[model samples]
Target: MSIAIKGGNIFQNSRPFFDEKMKFPSLEELTIINLRGIAELWHLANVEDEFPAFPNSENPGDSDALFNNKVALPAIKHIKMSLVDGLQKIWGSHLDVRSFNELESLDIKFVEKATKAFSLDAIQRIRNLKELNLQQFQLTGQFIERVGFYNDEVENSVLLPQLRNLKLDSFPQLKRIPWRELTLQNLRCLQISEIHDLTYLFPASICKRLVNLEALRVYDCHKMKEIVREELGDANTVEVKVVFPHLNFLRLSNLPAFQSLGSDNVILEFPSIKEVDFDKFQNPILWDLLQKLKPVKELQLGRCESLFELHDLKGRSSTMLPRLRNLTLSYMDNLQRIPWMIFPIKNLRYLKISYIHGLKFLFTASMCSEGFAQLEEIHIQDCKDIEQMLAQESIEDTSNNAAPITVVLPRVKIIKLYYLRSLRSFSSENYEALEFPSLEEVEIKEYDKEYFDLNTVIKKRCTTRLCYAR
Candidate 1:
């Protein structure tokens, strides 16, 4: 039932205090609509020119007490004051709001001129304050360099220990995260967005301090090259615990200079980490880190063009993922082939390979290779040289019993093939013959269809549906 008015005007006029007081005594709400687009107002100037002192009054008129004169509203739970500037000196020094204690929320908007120093004396006075949002405010750490603004410059580093959510945006000048002084025992979510000059916030050693932090996002910070950099390169020696153990989702994107996940110098272990998404890392280092970290169900590596070979099992390379269920490798221009020799996993259910312009083979295994029994779904798209899933070779009857024609499909159910311009044929009989008994469906998607007669072949040989789409 309450309404608000905007763009209205209220002129500066002096009046006897007793005249209008009795007229509007019983009025519940009074809105002094200011239509004037005046930007600057001072307490002394308003008191001297607008409202002069009473003829024989002994007490001086209080400019800061002006907000107290508004009509009282017992039902008012929220108040929004806009277009008010230079409020730093007004509330920072002498505002008294003990009577408005019942008010739970206050929103101050478009006050860009307010100094960051003003909050030191003002915020602590609001005893019942639960939530606060500072938008487009010119706040800086140097603003409260002394006098324990929040407490000490050390005390100034105060976190709403009770606060559960916080959002800070477009603050390019914010240089440091006061993690040392701020107490965030109950903080659950934090977002820092669009800050370009933020070179560093939390030191590598302090990532363990945010114990209760569940979700954190640091996005579009162009200047920050790494999260925990010093301990990440190939040569450091430190013990870095997986900071944010309770974190379930983490996104590090568009950071062009991001090199590796962690410093090789440190023994970094992510015991509780389940998801990681990173782009533009050297292949050797990327795989090395993957070998060191714990098993995650899903992993995505993008735009690492330098990765020519998946695993150099020829030397000290690691084994295949035992816990991976879905793996996607895309846009790896130099990847010549996937070295399945090092893979120790026979449990992979779904695998997708795409846009590896140079990728030649899915594995070095012959079609009759029994080592790949657990593979169920294979999706190959946009690969330039790979024309087929497996080569066909007829097996001669060598068993003791009479020849039994049977396809063994213990797991595979779906297969997809697409966009191999150079793919003249899928699995020609020239190579070793292969057999799949569990495969039930095959989908071929591409711009050219005549070169691949997958539908006719699947219907006659595999006895499965071969869906072709251009």
Candidate 2:
């Protein structure tokens, strides 16, 4: 039920890979890789006599009439093709629809010369397709329109009605995606990357149609200005509320022109989102969006040059990020320190910081005395100005009774420090050693031993494995 062909020039003379006389009743999966000089895949010798269901009709009715009884590969479910440079067409114009009616998944990658994957008529017949991935193709707007509906007025007409997952990547010439013309209610995952000419993603009319979308990731789009474009209708038009009820994972990275999701006329909501990643983003609007993401558990921010601090956290209540367990900050040269007062430290388990040039220390001595009860891992690397892990400070008291307190890290198990040239000690000179009841392993690389001693940082009775490199 499976056929695989790789690295061959067998069908080079404008011939079909599957001849008209061939009939495959039980073939289910087909994979072709690194094939050269292949012009076409399927062939039908007689177009009028063999398949006569939709001869003169513009709109085909009754899905059963599209399939021919004698069609080859009648039960095929999956097809994948990669690195087929010379392939011009997937199938002939008059090929029988039964060969692809049962197909569920189709993936094509690195087929640069092929302008389109399937003929307009052939794509509409594959009603059972659930997943489609096209990468490194030279397709344009015409290819997208060909796969979509030919006539919008056709009653109850939709293209790829059963498709659930769709990915389009590295299409440089593609400038627009006609979301309003396509019906994609069943789509769950949509990812688009490296489409340089695209200026915006979704128009206002297409938001309600993507009700089932769970994951949306757009990366490396240099010109994208908004995820959803604001449309101004007549004065009678009511306010628009854009909501993704089931979406949980969202990542937008390396988008320089992106400013906001939508304008003032639109209300944005992501009720089920749990994870968010933002990198190389420079906009104050991002802070407004983060204030609404109270349910996000894992957050990663990197290379945001304009960010000097968490400006929104300065005056807000401590209830922000109540569920956050993992946090990563990297390549932020202007950031001075972590705003510990805004973080819900009891729920934080993992903390990673790297390439932060301006930060001097991670926590204050008073902060360490409170203990990170649930913190499990600490990783710090490539920080040029960091002098210590904790800064020496006395606990604030109103009646002039301030006192130095003992540092307690009750649950921390692993500590990793690398390439921190300015780091002198774990804490300032006041605390000779810190309590590490659950410490198991410590790793230090490229650190100066003359400035700080390992014996002065940890208690001698604590049995901990230490790994040190030059």
Candidate 3:
């Protein structure tokens, strides 16, 4: 039921790969990769005899007269083609609308010569399709326009009504998505990457209809300025409320030109979001969005130049991210210190920091008593100015004499420190009070042996592995 052809001159001309008499009623999946010398997959010699209603057909009824005739690959459900240099068309003009009605998934990549995936008449009949992934195409917008929705006097018809997932990547010629003309109500997941010309992802008209979207990821888009463009009336006074009720996962990375989610006139809200990832973003608008996301549990931030500090806590008793559990920070060029007052240290379990050039220390001595009590793992790397893991500082005390503070990490199991050029000791004062009751493994790399001894730093009685990379 499945056929894959790769790296060969299997066919020599524009002839049909399957003869007219050879019927593949059970062929469900077909894949062609790196094939040469083939212009058309199915070529009918007499076009008018097989499809009398094909020339001016726009809707299904115009071709209904030829539906009774036998069609090729009637029950095919999946098709994928890649690196087919000479493939100009997948379905010949002679085929009627009912040829590949059962198709559920189509994946086409790096086939530059192919102008269109499906004919206008053929696309209207693929009502059962669920997934479509296209990448590295020249005329991507033209192909999408041909398969777009059609408006009839009686009703508005969608081209792919059953589609659930759509991904478009490396579309060099696509400047914008024609959301005003197309309707994908059932779409759940959309991932786009390497689209350099796209200005915005969605318009206000289509945001209301995407009620079922669960995951949306857009990365490596150089010219994308906004996730959604604002819509204004003739008087420029109307405001739009855009909400993604079911969306839970969002990732935006390597988008240097992105400024805001939408203009000031548009209000955007994501009530159900739980996880977010942002990388290489240099705008303060990202912080504004984070202030609105109070329910996030897992957050990853890397190379954000605008984030000099976490939102100024302003002496608030409660933390901003009360539900946060997992956090990762990397390449934060200007972050000099971690504001422990604004972090939910009691709930944090996993922490990783790397390439923070300006960070002097991670925690102050006064913060060690209650901070990171539930933390399980710690990883620190490439921090050149970190003089100590925990800075020595005095806590406010009523009596003149106070006992030495003991730092207890009751749940920590693993610790890794790499390439810390200025690290002098585990703690600024001494390494005696630190206790890792659940200690498992400790790894240190590229450190100066003259500064401190590893054996003196880790004295836990539990089994542990100490690895040093020179």
Q: Give candidate 3's error at residue 249 in angstroms.
A: 0.9
Top candidate when judged by lDDT against the true structure: 2
Error of 2 at 348 (Å): 2.3
Report the CA-based lDDT of candidate 1 relative to the real structure.
0.50
lDDT (10s digit) by residue, model 3, range 1-470: 98787876543333323433335689899898887655545444443353332322222221222122344668889988888665655543444444677889989887665555555555556789899898876653255334333456113546778889999888787777656545578889999899899878988778998998888999999999888877553356678889988888889899878888776667788888888888887646666656666677878888886675555643653746678888888888788886567667788888889999899888765576767888998999999998777765643342434555667788989888888878877765532256678888887787877876777667875554444533
Clashing pairs in 3: none
Model 2 agreement with the true structure over 1-470: per-residue lDDT tens digits: 99898885543343324433457888999998987655445544444454332322222222212123345778999999898755655643454755788999989888665545555566567789899898887763355324434465333456688989989888888787756545689999999999888878887778888899899999999898878766663342466789888888888889888877765566778888888888888747667657767788888888977666565556773666678888888998888877676667778899999999999988876666554678999999999899888775543332354444457788888888888878888876644235677887777777777786778787635444444533
lDDT score, candidate 1, position 300: 61
RMSD for each model, in Å, please? 9.6, 6.5, 6.1
